[model samples]
Target: MEQQRSFGSHTTGTLYLVPTPIGNLGDMTIRAIEILKTVDLIAAEDTRHTQMLLNHFEIKTKTISFHEHNTQMRIPELLAKLANGETIAQVSDAGMPSISDPGKELVRAAIDAGVPVVPLPGANAATTALIASGLPPQPFLFYGFLPRKAGEKNRELEKLAHESATLLFYESPHRVGKTLAAMQTAFGDRQAALARELTKKFETFIRGSLSALQTYAAGDLKGEFVIMVEGAADKPAVDVTVPLKMQVEAIVATGAKPNAAIKLVAKQNGLAKQVVYDAYHELEK
Candidate 1:
């Protein structure tokens, strides 16, 4: 009875969210390796691909597939194991999982189901690109990747135009040309950088205006890309005497994103936002 009761208490497993190397296998961390070894099972986005990585490091831990395609079905089973005291670790094909990789849904599900999720920060392409970008890092948004369609891509870039943060994105070599062009159109003459093939022998970082990057990609597009674009230049105080609401309404009328449009128009008009606010208040009334 004592042995059975002791064994029965083995329940609820902790989940670990592991970050793998984006390029070089040698970048894998010792803690990550130890966690992977200790976990009861490893839920990998691509088992075969991770096998190569594990084989490189001589990590003999068990790996199972739990990618986007099968995650819907596998998540429930994973949760069941977790509830039964089986520790599971998740890994993506490369870089961090769920940032354009699998494992995000599982992480959320695990959280909702009361499973403990331990995040082991290691290698991430977004930060890698941002650091190499040489752009001011403050107030930057990591967009991951834009939609493939030209119209949607442009729309997304338009939304980011007035963000005033260094913008970051991941891009494939094949699509880098078109992405640069769309960025040029949406961002206009903004400063930008293209960090490509990061942490690899051919790692390259191209810093210039978005227009310049477009031309570079036209001739020398190779390797994956992480593009970082400087936000729109801040408005000088040439204008600022209006109430905020009027500015908001004025920009909303021009089909600009209400928030960005308002701020830009306020700066352009050289009026205090109070005046714009009064005008907008009247309009509301």
Candidate 2:
């Protein structure tokens, strides 16, 4: 149990979670700049990348490297500084720290040590793309960067297939097409939008069905990508008591291929495909 009074007087120093610009440096907030200027130390995901931002703003505060590779070793050192009442600011390469970045562990450690953690509002690629996505804005899930492996990505998509809230994801230029294609298979050609190069001069948003976006991405996949997918339409309540084998049969009776029926039944019932396959085959026999 940790209590945080952001501006309260405490013996320990506060940890500021500062958000950097996702692309455009102009997106950096005034408060973020002030905090960066005054903080005792800045723990940046990429010291060299952050140096450019610091130089642009003329911020002279000292900085140290704190990214994925060195997080385990850096946490204890950062925590020690915080314990010594040295205010520390954590910033990622872009956007808010710990939002698909490298500040979560340090923040967790600071909280466990009873240190205050304060977050400043600033530029975020996910939310920036979301507002202009032309899809339902509220009640969206920000899933930053899907798994790279095909099977893992498919399983993750399977879990989210029934979600009713708008879905958001970050993908690299190289993986955007493949990710969109996977989304098409899992979600079945839902309304989708792809936002790329956000806040930069070449920013572009492509809105259409998932299939259409996949095709568009295939041609020229450059710049970072933020994908916003319309939610699964409100499905009528399903009867969970129905036997898995019967569900497969019903889908098959509707002219769906046996293999496709098994997959559909497995997804609907939240059962393994093998389980549904075995039951369906036994029913056939």
lDDT of 1 by residue, 35-93 (tens): 88888999998899999888887888898899877978999999999998899999998
The top-ranked prediction according to lDDT is 2
The ten-residue window of minimal lDDT in model 2 covers 251-260
Candidate 1, position 235, lDDT: 56
> Once superposed on the true structure, which residue ranges of model 1 sit more than 4 Å away at CA?
1-11, 238-285
Please give, for residues 5-85, the per-residue lDDT of candidate 2 as tens digits.
889689999899999998999888899999999999999999999999999999999999999999999999999999999
For candidate 1, the lDDT comes to: 0.79
lDDT of 1 at 268: 74
